[model samples]
Target: MDPLERLSSPAPEFLDRLAASTRALHWLVALPVLLLLLTGLTNFWPELKALHVGGARVFAWLHVLIGLGFAVALVPSVIAILMRRAARRDARELLAFGLDDYLWLQHRVLRAAGLRSVGPRVGKFNAGQKLNAVLSAAATAALMGTGVVLGVNYWSKDVFDVDLVGAVFRWHTVLSVLLLPLIAGHLYMALLNPGTRESLRGVTTGRVRRSWAERHHGAWADRVREERRAGEG
Candidate 1:
């Protein structure tokens, strides 16, 4: 089937699924990351820094506030998943990776470039998306840790020597720069790519069109079918 045809709603036999907690957490996490990027850019570029008086100082404090929000934002999703049985199951489905995911990555890249669909059956989270999630989580943790350290130095002089804090700041800055490409690619896939646009609804509404799920995540579609059949039986 043409991928575009599947953009519309699919039959009930096709599953529409994503945890409500997952949907909420995505937006929660996105806010601070975007704020950090915006403020960091102003501080990073001298010309931009010079454009507004006290902008750097103002954003520095704002970054700290958002940084704290970033840290807090991660906790509720994890807690909700662990506490809710359905969410726990969904988390497992998202985290599990096997042979199909590896093959999907190999072909999906080519398919995205206009080649034929020669990929293996993919799950709800494709290999690329899974990798993106893992990397993004790790980067967020690192940013939070480094940001805290930097914030400490800014407010108090006695916690650690200036040199140690400077080194940590450098690492934080480097990680922030490295994250740009991943963020850019994520935006392209989530917003710009026509084929994947429907997937965005999963985050916004806790479900995507069943057709898009099946077309992009065939293996996951199969699993959902099995679960539904088992439940009925």
Candidate 2:
């Protein structure tokens, strides 16, 4: 088949990417995080501040609930990672960046800017995904900690002073701002980028087109094939 036809054709087979547990955990946090991001708009955008005070307060509390639920949603994954060896290995592999990951990213940046560049081999995850995962974990921890403090302050009388609450609020707001781009870029790659849109099935359904996997994750895809053959033989 021609290169264009091959690229455009439906894949002949699919490969498993995420486990059932992982996909469930993903949505558990994703839904609430989306709610938090939507409600969080009131906290930053200047025009939204002028909305009805009562409505704004409602959103503010709703944000708190969502944030708390987000943290709660992570509990099972955390425990499973700690207790299950395979989960730990998967987490480490997904998050850690090696030399090739750096080189791959360098080439990607150069190519994106229309410069000549040679790319390195890609594994199961790319540098961007690894960085996103790291940033996401850090953002989760930061938001959760600051959120708990702020939430506590909201319900109690004089438990946390104004200055302390203000400081925590600033950190929370700043972290939220930083997380926005990561979310946007992630969505764009999954939903809009033709090269990657096919992989969305891997996240949602735990399987992706074999052709898509081989092209984007050659190293890992080859290894999986090798392991499968070895097991069968």
Candidate 3:
């Protein structure tokens, strides 16, 4: 029997546990991103120049701290991903897709521009989410790489050249700018879309309504049911 099937017919305790774990991790990821953005802005804008020197220094320290935190968070995230991968071996839900997911993506775009009537049905993850995850991961790596170079240069110039450090800083800035729009889009989707907003409740509460799971993860729900029945019989 599959664990997901058991989840579909979740005991109250199981649901509670799932909700709490999911919510904790989601907020853990979100808070730092928000802080990093606020601090980064104060560090960058000229109109906010008065805050730049002090703000940038503070932000730089904070960013590095948050980056280290992210690295720590990745340990658990990676473990979860591995466990999920083992469970879903071939299904690969995170990378899964079908006609519905594509249509949903199209519907979202049209709706965003006030051109669509109905949204598309999505499975465990829509195409947009997959894209966002990939982009965010790449951007994070780039930011961390550039940060390391800059930090090394700042603390010990003899380890690397001034020119190289400058170049890395430029790369970090460019990647950060590229990440801004995607982050904004992610926030808007999470906050503005009714379905997404409800889904996001799981981030804070740790457990989403059963209906939300049925609607957004129908296939997963189906699998969970199958697994449970198999386990019972």
Candidate 4:
């Protein structure tokens, strides 16, 4: 008999991970967020800005529009987490970080630096991933807050003082610059990094190879197995 095979039923090769609604919300927020990044960055880039010379106002307005949409899009996800049990569980899983996650991160760093260290088992998310998620969310919230002030001031200078606008402007630029690397690393891990790139399938297709999950996210994979067996029982 196969190792994964049990008396109840044979093992599953692909396990359901992300739900369809989760994927839908991801795409909904992702599009406007990506556009905001593009428009926001282009406004700061001298060469890029020169191409659109007099059209700076247009891009700036576009950025503000997208920012508003992104803020609105996030509200539903937050509401779901508050109102739905499944979303709450997923939020907990995504945000959880403890000793195992820390140990896994330490070993990963040491291995990357060519030092020997035994890898530790981690749940659905490791420390680095949870950190990334937390930072990204923080960045999103910060940008939204600062962007709103800037947007309001732009439309009506009487709304906020020059000193306040100047302060938020500096902070907005700094946060935007800092967020780029985090976003790059996230994309690399999802699309380029050999080790965890397969996880992209879980987000996109709602399923991942059981073997890959067992190796990379053993704790979560075991929980999934147990849940499935319980349901069968």
Q: Give me the candidate number with maximum TM-score.
A: 2
- For candidate 4, the per-residue lDDT at 207 reads 91
| lDDT: worst 10-residue window of model 2 | 48-57
Which pairs, if any, clash in model 1?
none
lDDT of 2: 0.79
Off by over 4 Å in 4: 1-12, 50-56
lDDT of each: 0.76, 0.79, 0.65, 0.79
- Superposed Cα deviation of residue 113, candidate 4 (Å): 1.6
Q: How close is candidate 2 to the true structure, as a TM-score?
A: 0.88
**Compared with the true structure, what per-residue lDDT tens digits does model 2 show for residues 107-180?**
99999999999887688889988999899778867988998898878677479889989999999989988999
Where is model 2 more than 4 Å wrong at Cα?
1-3, 6-11, 45-56, 81-86
What's the candidate order when arranged by decreasing TM-score? 2, 4, 1, 3
> Could you tell me every candidate's TM-score relative to the true structure?
0.84, 0.88, 0.68, 0.87
- Candidate 1 residue lDDT tens string, 1-233: 35446454344333557777666556767877988888887876776555544544666777777776667666765686568776676667667778887888878678879888777777668888887877887887898889888877777889988899989989998889888888989989789788887777777777766666777877777888898899999
After aligning candidate 1 to the native by TM-score, how far in Å is the CA of 153 from where it should be?
Answer: 1.5
Candidate 4 lDDT score relative to the true structure: 0.79
lDDT, residue 221, candidate 2: 92
Cα miss at 223, model 1 (Å)? Answer: 2.4
Alpha-carbon RMSD of each model: 3.3, 2.8, 6.9, 4.7
Error of 2 at 24 (Å): 2.2
